[model samples]
Target: MTGSTLVGALVVGLAVGAVGRLVLPGRKAVPVWLTLALGVAAALLGAIVVGLVDRRPGGSPLLPLVVQTGFAAVAVVLAVVAAGRQTSPDPAARRKEEV
Candidate 1:
C-alpha cells in the first residue's frame, strides 16, 4: 500500500479503537499495545466489510472513510462484549458450590 493508504489505515484504526474503548467502559487489563492492535484489527475488518458491500475489490479513494466509521461502530460493539466479559467474573464458582 502507498504511504497515504497506510496513513488512512492508522487513522481508521485509532478512531475505531477510541470508539471501542468508549463503548466498553469498564475495568480492563488492556494495555496501550492491545488497544492499538484491536484498533488495527477493527480497521481491517471494517475495510473488508465495506469493500464487500461496495463491491470494491481492493479499496477505493472514498471507501476508507465510510468503512472506517462503520467499522469503528462495530469495534465498539465487540469491545463492549470483550470488556463486559473481562469485568464480570464467573458468578457460579464451582469450588464454592462443592464446599
Candidate 2:
C-alpha cells in the first residue's frame, strides 16, 4: 500500500481498537499496541470478507465499518483472555510465597 494508505489504515485501526475496547463489558488487560495491531488486522480481514460477500458495485458504506468494528471487538476479547492466561499467577506458587 502507499504511504497515505498506510497512514489512513493506522488512523482507522486506532479508532476501531478504541471502539472495540469500549464494546467489551469490562476493562481489558490488553496493551494499546496489541489492540492497534489487532484492529488493523481485523479491518483488513473485514474488508476482504465484505468484498467476497457483498460484490455489488454500490453497497452501504456502513457495512464494512460495522464488520470491522465487530472483528475488532472479538480481537480485543481474545487478546484480553490470552493476556490474562499468561499473567495469572500460579496458585501453588502463590501459596508457597505466602508461607
Candidate 3:
C-alpha cells in the first residue's frame, strides 16, 4: 500500500476506535493504542468482508465504514473483557482481602 493510503487508514482507524469506545456502555479501561490497533484490524477485516459480499463496482462507501465501526465496537468489548480477565484478582485473594 502507498504511504498515503496507510496514513489514511490510520486516521480512519483512530476515528473508528474512538467511535467504538463511545458506543460501548459503561466505563472501559481500554488503552488508546490497543483501541487504535483493534480499529485498524477491524477496518481491514471489514474491507475484506465487504469485498467478499459485494463484488459490484462503485458500491456505496458507507456500508464499509459502518461495518468497520461495528467491528471496532465488538473489538473494544472483547479487549475490555480480556483485560478484565487478566487483571481480575483471584477468588482466594478476594476472600482473604475481605477477611
- Could you tell me every candidate's TM-score relative to the true structure? 0.57, 0.67, 0.68
Please report, in order, the local distance difference test score of every candidate based on alpha carbons: 0.65, 0.70, 0.70
Candidate 1 residue-pair clash tally = 0
Report the lDDT tens digits of candidate 3 across residue range 5-82: 345456667887777677766666778788879988876666667668977677786776677667666776788777
Winner on lDDT (1 vs 3): 3
Error of 3 at 42 (Å): 1.1
Give the alpha carbon lDDT tens digit for every residue of 1-99 in model 1: 346655776788887676566656666556645676777776776666655677546546787777766766676566556654553345567456556
- lDDT by residue for model 2 over 1-99, one digit each (tens)? 235434544566678787767776666678778888898887667666776898777778777667766776677678877775563278988778668
Model 3 alpha-carbon miss at residue 60, Å: 1.0
- The TM-score between candidate 1 and the true structure equals 0.57
Superpose all Cα atoms of candidate 2 onto the true structure and report the RMSD in Å to 1 decimal: 4.1
